[model samples]
Target: MRFLETDEHDDPILSVVNLVDLFLVVIAVLMIVIVSNPLNPFSDKSVVVIENPGQADMRMLVKDGEELREYESSGEIGEGEGIKAGVAYRLADGRMVYVPEAPAGGASGGAASADGAAQ
Candidate 1:
């Protein structure tokens, strides 16, 4: 009779142990996921990182109204004044696709001449 009573009480303790084990497993999995997430606080900023990648050189420029900005391969950003808004992207194939700006008149004409001479 005494042994039967002890076994009955052991069931409650065993249940508690199983519950703790289950929670431990859950916490471990959550920690793994947090560490592996790309947006985790410990991760680096999400910028284009080029490894020993191919020679696919590219250039991107952004403009806001009359202001133009250039982004270089060495990660240098430059700003300059321009006419109408436009964006220029130089692809790896050596093709420069740019948005048309406002009609040229004064400074633009000289700039165009200089650019053509340089090429």
Candidate 2:
């Protein structure tokens, strides 16, 4: 009579199956979180993350077209191909206002404006 009373809860294999199922659920949740992030590697839009922003010797991580590059600041200005097309002023309210420099050429000014905001 006592042997006949053993039921589903008495099976040790069921406990192992439950543990595996819990692990699978946790793994699925982690995968979803990783893919949904804005800066995820699988995302299409490129992202640039600045390390120690506003510091002269900071570093940068640039992602473009599935490629990644790291740039470190040397605390000195570097030569680059671009025009200074705007001046940004931080207002009292902690907001920035960018005033576009006068157009020097036909398309150069437009390109600078588009890229300046990214910095």
Tens-digit lDDT track for model 2 on 53-84? 87987999888868888999888876889888
**Candidate 1 lDDT (Cα, 0 to 1):** 0.56
Task: Mark the regions of model 2 whose C-alpha exceeds 4 Å error after superposition.
Answer: 77-119
In model 1, the clashing pairs are none
Off by over 4 Å in 1: 1-5, 8-10, 45-119
Residue 86 lDDT in candidate 2: 78
**Candidate lDDT values, in order:** 0.56, 0.78
* Model 1 residue 9 CA deviation in Å: 8.6
> lDDT tens digits, residues 98-118, model 1?
544556573432222213432
